[model samples]
Target: MDLNLRKAILSNIESNDQKQLEATIVEAIQNGEEKMLPGLGVLFELIWKQSDEQDKQEMINALEQGVKQETTG
Candidate 1:
């Protein structure tokens, strides 16, 4: 069986409002389940595709800082 995770995730959340989207994201992260990773990755992919160069750079910087914090803390 071939499953398109990105499509599935997008379809599921396509009609969500800001509050609903925030709740979904918060629930997924707070659940801390590995199954949610693909959904988060798809979300990130969407954000990356929509972001301008400066936004992308800021995201990279934040990721770098997060990685460093994880390693050092």
Candidate 2:
């Protein structure tokens, strides 16, 4: 079977507005299901692709801080 997970994920959320998108993300994270990881990753990939260099750096810094906190806490 041919499956394009990223395309599928995008299609699912394409019509969502800002508030709806936030709700989807929050619900997915709160659910804490392993299956949601791929969808979140797809969303992150889209964000990364659309981001400017400064935005990318900020995301990296935030991620680094999150990882450090996770490891040290």
Candidate 3:
């Protein structure tokens, strides 16, 4: 699970030696795995930590609108 990966990532970052993480990410992307989607999902889930309320609301509204439009149209 991500518990190990999160720990490793934290260790790598704290150690300032993220080459393994970078290489692993690049290799996964090159292999055409579904890693990109989950990466984005993790990013999206954590976005509120760095986003303002208004920006967060707008992003959620836009995503909901897009989903609704996709489903209806």
Top candidate when judged by lDDT against the true structure? 2
Off by over 4 Å in 1: none
Worst 10 residues of 2 by lDDT: 38-47
Query: Which digits, one per residue and each the tens of the lDDT, describe model 3 over residues 1-73?
Result: 4366544434544543357556655665688777465553444554667899999999999999999998999
How are the candidates ranked when ordered by TM-score, highest leading? 2, 1, 3
Which sections of candidate 2 miss by over 4 Å?
none
Clashing pairs in 3: none
Across residues 1-73, which tens digit of lDDT does each residue of candidate 2 receive?
9999988999999999999999989989999999999999998998999999999999999999999998999
lDDT of 2: 0.95
The residue ranges of model 3 lying beyond 4 angstroms of the native Cα positions read 1-33
Query: How far is 68's C-alpha from truth in model 2 (Å)?
Result: 0.8
Pairs that collide in candidate 2 are: none
Each model's TM-score, in the order given? 0.92, 0.92, 0.50
Q: Tens digits of per-residue lDDT for model 1 on 23-70? A: 988999999999999998888898899999999999999999999998
